[model samples]
Target: MYYSRKRLMDDLPEEVTAIWSCTNEKCNGWMRDNFVLSARPTCVQCNSFMEKGEKLLPVLENANHKQSK
Candidate 1:
């Protein structure tokens, strides 16, 4: 008999917030959320890897309010 751990649908982590575009003026590329077992995530756009999305700081904060100074 084989027992496979069942994951409850509701138990899954919340949806990841996607970082839209790059913050660097030289290359404002788009990015996607990445997940790793240990820690750290990489920007799909610029490949500017980070441990967590939050660590990116103002770079990832460039969501809708792009024009703001």
Candidate 2:
């Protein structure tokens, strides 16, 4: 019998939004704009300055955000 498990990440919504991408060619890091609180965000991977752009990435909820009662 063959067992194939489904990945939870694959089921996430593919919502397009603005994000920051690493300027460094060696680094492949990015952050969602809604998740970041900065006019100029930096790269989390190589500590380099990030560039603004849009991508069709999965929609993720910010865990740091406070939920309303």
Which has the greatest lDDT? 2
TM-score, each model? 0.23, 0.67
Per-residue alpha-carbon lDDT of model 1 for 1-69, expressed as tens digits?
Answer: 674456444344554464444455666454343323223444555766443233232222325443322
In TM-score terms, candidate 2 sits at 0.67
- Global lDDT of each candidate: 0.42, 0.81
Going through the candidates in order, what is the number of backbone clashes in each? 0, 0
Q: Which candidate leads in TM-score?
A: 2
Q: Local error of candidate 1 at 33, Å?
A: 1.0
- In model 2, the worst 10-residue window by lDDT is 60-69
